[model samples]
Target: MKEYFNNIYLALSTIFIGMSVTFKHLFVPAVTIQYPSVKPQLPTRERNRLYVNMDDCIGCLQCARACPVNCIEIETVKKIPDEDLGLTSNGKK
Candidate 1:
Protein backbone atom coordinates (compact mmCIF):
# COMPACT_ATOMS: atom_id res chain seq x y z
CA MET A 1 0.00 0.00 0.00
CA LYS A 2 2.12 2.86 1.37
CA GLU A 3 5.37 1.29 0.13
CA TYR A 4 3.87 0.74 -3.34
CA PHE A 5 2.78 4.36 -3.54
CA ASN A 6 6.24 5.58 -2.49
CA ASN A 7 7.92 3.43 -5.16
CA ILE A 8 5.51 4.72 -7.81
CA TYR A 9 6.20 8.33 -6.80
CA LEU A 10 9.96 7.72 -6.91
CA ALA A 11 9.71 6.18 -10.37
CA LEU A 12 7.62 9.07 -11.69
CA SER A 13 10.06 11.66 -10.27
CA THR A 14 13.03 9.85 -11.77
CA ILE A 15 11.41 9.68 -15.19
CA PHE A 16 10.49 13.38 -15.07
CA ILE A 17 13.99 14.37 -13.97
CA GLY A 18 15.59 12.37 -16.79
CA MET A 19 13.16 13.83 -19.34
CA SER A 20 13.93 17.34 -18.15
CA VAL A 21 17.65 16.75 -18.61
CA THR A 22 17.09 15.38 -22.13
CA PHE A 23 14.91 18.36 -23.06
CA LYS A 24 17.48 20.82 -21.68
CA HIS A 25 20.29 19.21 -23.66
CA LEU A 26 18.24 19.12 -26.87
CA PHE A 27 18.18 22.94 -27.03
CA VAL A 28 21.79 23.49 -25.90
CA PRO A 29 24.61 24.15 -28.35
CA ALA A 30 27.16 21.42 -28.75
CA VAL A 31 30.65 21.88 -27.31
CA THR A 32 32.26 19.25 -29.52
CA ILE A 33 34.94 20.23 -32.03
CA GLN A 34 36.64 18.35 -34.83
CA TYR A 35 39.75 17.30 -32.98
CA PRO A 36 41.52 16.03 -36.10
CA SER A 37 41.02 19.23 -38.08
CA VAL A 38 41.30 21.72 -35.25
CA LYS A 39 44.76 22.41 -33.96
CA PRO A 40 45.38 23.91 -30.55
CA GLN A 41 47.36 27.13 -30.22
CA LEU A 42 50.26 26.94 -27.82
CA PRO A 43 52.34 29.73 -26.32
CA THR A 44 55.95 30.37 -27.30
CA ARG A 45 57.34 29.38 -23.87
CA GLU A 46 55.33 26.15 -23.63
CA ARG A 47 57.41 22.99 -24.10
CA ASN A 48 55.78 19.66 -24.88
CA ARG A 49 59.00 17.70 -24.80
CA LEU A 50 62.40 17.70 -23.16
CA TYR A 51 65.39 19.42 -24.79
CA VAL A 52 68.93 19.78 -23.57
CA ASN A 53 72.17 21.46 -24.58
CA MET A 54 74.82 18.95 -23.63
CA ASP A 55 77.71 21.30 -24.24
CA ASP A 56 76.40 24.33 -22.33
CA CYS A 57 75.30 22.18 -19.44
CA ILE A 58 78.22 22.41 -17.00
CA GLY A 59 76.44 19.49 -15.32
CA CYS A 60 75.31 21.98 -12.64
CA LEU A 61 71.74 20.58 -12.78
CA GLN A 62 70.37 24.01 -11.91
CA CYS A 63 67.29 23.74 -14.12
CA ALA A 64 66.33 20.38 -12.66
CA ARG A 65 66.67 21.74 -9.13
CA ALA A 66 64.61 24.81 -9.98
CA CYS A 67 61.56 22.81 -11.14
CA PRO A 68 58.77 23.25 -8.63
CA VAL A 69 56.99 20.06 -9.70
CA ASN A 70 60.23 18.06 -9.82
CA CYS A 71 59.55 17.29 -13.47
CA ILE A 72 63.06 18.17 -14.67
CA GLU A 73 65.83 15.59 -14.94
CA ILE A 74 69.61 16.04 -15.01
CA GLU A 75 72.48 13.66 -15.60
CA THR A 76 76.16 14.57 -15.58
CA VAL A 77 79.55 12.91 -15.52
CA LYS A 78 82.43 14.42 -13.57
CA LYS A 79 84.86 16.09 -15.97
CA ILE A 80 88.31 17.53 -15.35
CA PRO A 81 87.22 20.73 -17.25
CA ASP A 82 90.28 20.19 -19.43
CA GLU A 83 88.23 17.88 -21.62
CA ASP A 84 87.01 19.22 -24.93
CA LEU A 85 83.78 21.15 -24.41
CA GLY A 86 81.38 21.79 -27.25
CA LEU A 87 79.18 24.82 -27.79
CA THR A 88 75.58 24.83 -26.56
CA SER A 89 72.73 24.14 -28.93
CA ASN A 90 71.83 27.84 -28.79
CA GLY A 91 75.44 28.66 -29.91
CA LYS A 92 76.14 30.17 -26.49
CA LYS A 93 79.78 29.97 -25.47
Candidate 2:
Protein backbone atom coordinates (compact mmCIF):
# COMPACT_ATOMS: atom_id res chain seq x y z
CA MET A 1 0.00 0.00 0.00
CA LYS A 2 2.90 2.40 0.84
CA GLU A 3 4.71 1.59 -2.44
CA TYR A 4 1.55 2.28 -4.45
CA PHE A 5 1.11 5.66 -2.71
CA ASN A 6 4.81 6.52 -3.37
CA ASN A 7 4.41 5.71 -7.08
CA ILE A 8 1.27 7.92 -7.29
CA TYR A 9 3.07 10.81 -5.58
CA LEU A 10 6.05 10.50 -7.98
CA ALA A 11 3.71 10.45 -11.02
CA LEU A 12 1.82 13.52 -9.80
CA SER A 13 5.08 15.38 -9.07
CA THR A 14 6.43 14.60 -12.55
CA ILE A 15 3.18 15.76 -14.19
CA PHE A 16 3.24 19.07 -12.20
CA ILE A 17 6.91 19.57 -13.18
CA GLY A 18 5.99 19.19 -16.89
CA MET A 19 3.02 21.56 -16.52
CA SER A 20 5.19 24.16 -14.66
CA VAL A 21 7.74 24.17 -17.49
CA THR A 22 4.94 24.78 -20.03
CA PHE A 23 3.47 27.64 -17.88
CA LYS A 24 6.93 29.25 -17.47
CA HIS A 25 7.53 29.33 -21.26
CA LEU A 26 4.06 30.86 -21.85
CA PHE A 27 5.32 34.13 -20.20
CA VAL A 28 8.35 34.38 -22.55
CA PRO A 29 8.41 36.79 -25.50
CA ALA A 30 6.78 35.48 -28.68
CA VAL A 31 8.49 35.76 -32.13
CA THR A 32 5.11 35.63 -33.87
CA ILE A 33 4.35 38.47 -36.30
CA GLN A 34 1.00 40.34 -36.41
CA TYR A 35 -0.47 39.20 -39.72
CA PRO A 36 -2.50 41.76 -41.82
CA SER A 37 -0.84 44.47 -39.66
CA VAL A 38 2.45 43.57 -41.38
CA LYS A 39 2.67 42.52 -45.02
CA PRO A 40 5.46 40.18 -46.10
CA GLN A 41 7.80 41.53 -48.80
CA LEU A 42 7.81 39.57 -52.07
CA PRO A 43 10.47 39.54 -54.77
CA THR A 44 9.71 41.20 -58.12
CA ARG A 45 8.37 39.03 -61.03
CA GLU A 46 7.93 35.98 -58.75
CA ARG A 47 5.09 33.94 -60.26
CA ASN A 48 3.21 31.07 -58.58
CA ARG A 49 1.17 30.47 -61.75
CA LEU A 50 1.88 30.54 -65.51
CA TYR A 51 -0.22 32.91 -67.66
CA VAL A 52 -0.56 32.30 -71.41
CA ASN A 53 -1.39 34.95 -74.05
CA MET A 54 -3.97 33.63 -76.48
CA ASP A 55 -3.21 36.39 -79.05
CA ASP A 56 0.43 35.30 -79.10
CA CYS A 57 -0.66 31.69 -79.62
CA ILE A 58 -1.24 30.45 -83.17
CA GLY A 59 -3.53 27.67 -81.94
CA CYS A 60 -0.43 25.43 -81.65
CA LEU A 61 -1.84 23.63 -78.51
CA GLN A 62 1.80 22.97 -77.65
CA CYS A 63 1.50 24.02 -74.00
CA ALA A 64 -1.70 22.00 -73.51
CA ARG A 65 -0.25 18.90 -75.19
CA ALA A 66 3.09 19.30 -73.36
CA CYS A 67 1.57 19.09 -69.86
CA PRO A 68 2.46 15.70 -68.27
CA VAL A 69 -1.07 15.10 -66.88
CA ASN A 70 -2.77 17.03 -69.74
CA CYS A 71 -4.24 19.44 -67.12
CA ILE A 72 -4.38 22.31 -69.64
CA GLU A 73 -7.51 22.31 -71.81
CA ILE A 74 -7.22 24.28 -75.06
CA GLU A 75 -9.79 24.95 -77.78
CA THR A 76 -8.18 25.57 -81.20
CA VAL A 77 -9.88 27.51 -83.99
CA LYS A 78 -8.54 28.05 -87.50
CA LYS A 79 -7.47 31.60 -88.36
CA ILE A 80 -6.74 33.13 -91.79
CA PRO A 81 -3.03 33.54 -92.63
CA ASP A 82 -3.55 37.28 -93.34
CA GLU A 83 -5.06 37.98 -89.87
CA ASP A 84 -2.99 40.04 -87.46
CA LEU A 85 -2.01 38.68 -84.01
CA GLY A 86 -0.08 40.31 -81.16
CA LEU A 87 3.47 39.22 -80.19
CA THR A 88 4.53 37.18 -77.15
CA SER A 89 6.61 38.52 -74.23
CA ASN A 90 9.61 36.63 -75.72
CA GLY A 91 8.84 38.13 -79.18
CA LYS A 92 7.59 34.77 -80.54
CA LYS A 93 4.83 34.78 -83.20
Candidate 2's residue-wise lDDT over 30-84, tens digit each?
7876877976667987655555776576677778876767788988777689996
RMSD of 2: 16.0
Point out where model 2 deviates above 4 Å.
34-93
| Residue ranges of candidate 1 with Cα displaced over 4 Å | 37-93
**Per-prediction TM-score to the true structure, in the order listed:** 0.34, 0.36
- lDDT by residue (1-93, candidate 1, tens digit) is 999999999999999999999999999996887766996778989866545666667877877876768897877777678886656778866
Clashing pairs in 2: none
After best superposition, candidate 2 residue 36: deviation in angstroms? 6.8
lDDT at position 80, candidate 2: 80
Q: What's the TM for model 1?
A: 0.34
Which 10 successive residues of model 1 have the least lDDT summed?
A: 47-56
- lDDT per prediction? 0.79, 0.80
- Cα RMSD, each candidate: 15.0, 16.0
Q: After superposition, how far is residue 18 of candidate 1 from its true place, in Å?
A: 2.4
The numbered model that scores best in TM-score is 2
